[model samples]
Target: MSGVAKVVAFMQRSWWRAALVFAVLAVAFVVFGRYAVPPSTALTSGALALELVGTRSGAVAVLRAFEQQHSVHAAWVSITWDFAFIASYVAVLVLALRYFARPGEPDLIDRTAAKSAVLAGAADCLENLGMLAMLAASPQQPPDWLGFAAFATTVASLVKWVLAAFAAGHALWLAWRKLAQR
Candidate 1:
């Protein structure tokens, strides 16, 4: 069998493990948000405002807001913690997609959902890097590249959310159907 088939086989068998890890990571994510990171108004903004601040001015404003609230370090910590969360979520989603597949063959939707999970992870990584870069730059007198970084980060964040939602929704729907049949 091909490498892909081997991986699918492995994932199909390890779905429970993936689900366990995902549960742990989800709790950790919440803990990090609540305790590890300091409370701040900037951080409490909606997801899009936090991740999709597309314009340079908007990015600068966010940075300034964090600084003013004395939560820049908290923002950094949150982003760092998110890296691990991304891995866990992607793994769980992919495994869940594979779990719904036939013994040796994944249907097109399953394959697509798995691929979307991976792509979402990649996009999230890009968005985190861009946010880090923006944080590194001076929000007051932003660098020329800051605008591009903001735009790119916004795009990546958008892609990540869309793909992740699709993958997660598909997996949940499949699970729901399975449960209903049982």
Candidate 2:
């Protein structure tokens, strides 16, 4: 078979894995909606870290505040998590478009591959946000307020690690391109 035909067949076979991702995301979304949980309030490391720290800074005060406003506030926490998803989604989609379309190739558009990649990335984001949110919103917590300070610190470190990976990836990509041009 020709090169193009071979690639097309490969994608068709692999498409099932991609569909499964979206199906899982839909289930998670339904669960989150039922719980009346916004993704940001539930997920997003930075925001959860903030709440953890804030709760620690003055536990009585934090409890008092949460009790007072938790009932009154709109479901805006999801908005924060939603923003994070958009950012990650765009980055992943850009990377996917580059890979599938392979701009240097004669065909400028690999429409099926490009579209599939974006859908997969979005599903990944939703799943991640859902997982994090569920963790943050869990009923169980340390009996002592001070322990949550430690939780905040741990989350901050994880966020740092995530950022470092992205920065390293970007630097490497740039360096590779520069050397290739030489």
Candidate 3:
């Protein structure tokens, strides 16, 4: 098999593994996410964002819970969480960009891939900015409950969904493209 053929075969074969990993990760997050998050003085962004947000439970709760469990200060946890969040956001963004980036030598496939990558990269940036804004608003000032709600819904949830949608769209597009090529 050609390199591209091999890559495609690998992806097809491992698709179930990918889905399983995602499922397991989701379960793990549901179990441990509440503990991993630090107390929030502000709103959440990035992965914390949701499409259907409830004003009742949110990032602040998770953050507080994590801090209490770990017996650490919110201040310290915030710093560590901030870095980890940023790193995760950056890593996703880079991967998203590469999804469309390798347009093969001026060919249409290359161009299409490049466009997907660029869009994914842009999504990553927007996601990062949203996350960064949340991080910025979180420190020192005690967060207004209304502000947290808004941040959680608008900045956090909206951004998270947008990124997910983009990723899903790219995946479908790539699959179709590959199949069409075959």
State the lDDT of candidate 3 residue by residue for 84-132, as single tens digits.
Answer: 4433433333333333233443356444543443454444445444434
Q: In terms of TM-score, how similar is model 3 to the real structure?
A: 0.36
Give the TM-scores of the predictions, in the order they appear: 0.81, 0.31, 0.36
Q: What is the clash tally of candidate 3?
A: 11
lDDT of 1 by residue, 7-86 (tens): 55654566585466457757765664454344555676722465789998898888887777776776777788778778
Give per-residue lDDT, candidate 1, residue 123: 100
Off by over 4 Å in 2: 1-60, 71-142, 145-165, 168-182
Report the lDDT tens digits of candidate 2 across residue range 71-124.
213323553344445444434443333333333542423443444434444443
Cα error, residue 71 of model 3, in Å, equals 6.3
| Top candidate when judged by lDDT against the true structure | 1
Query: For all candidates, what are the clash counts?
Result: 0, 3, 11
User: Which residue pairs in model 1 clash with each other?
Assistant: none
lDDT of each: 0.76, 0.41, 0.43
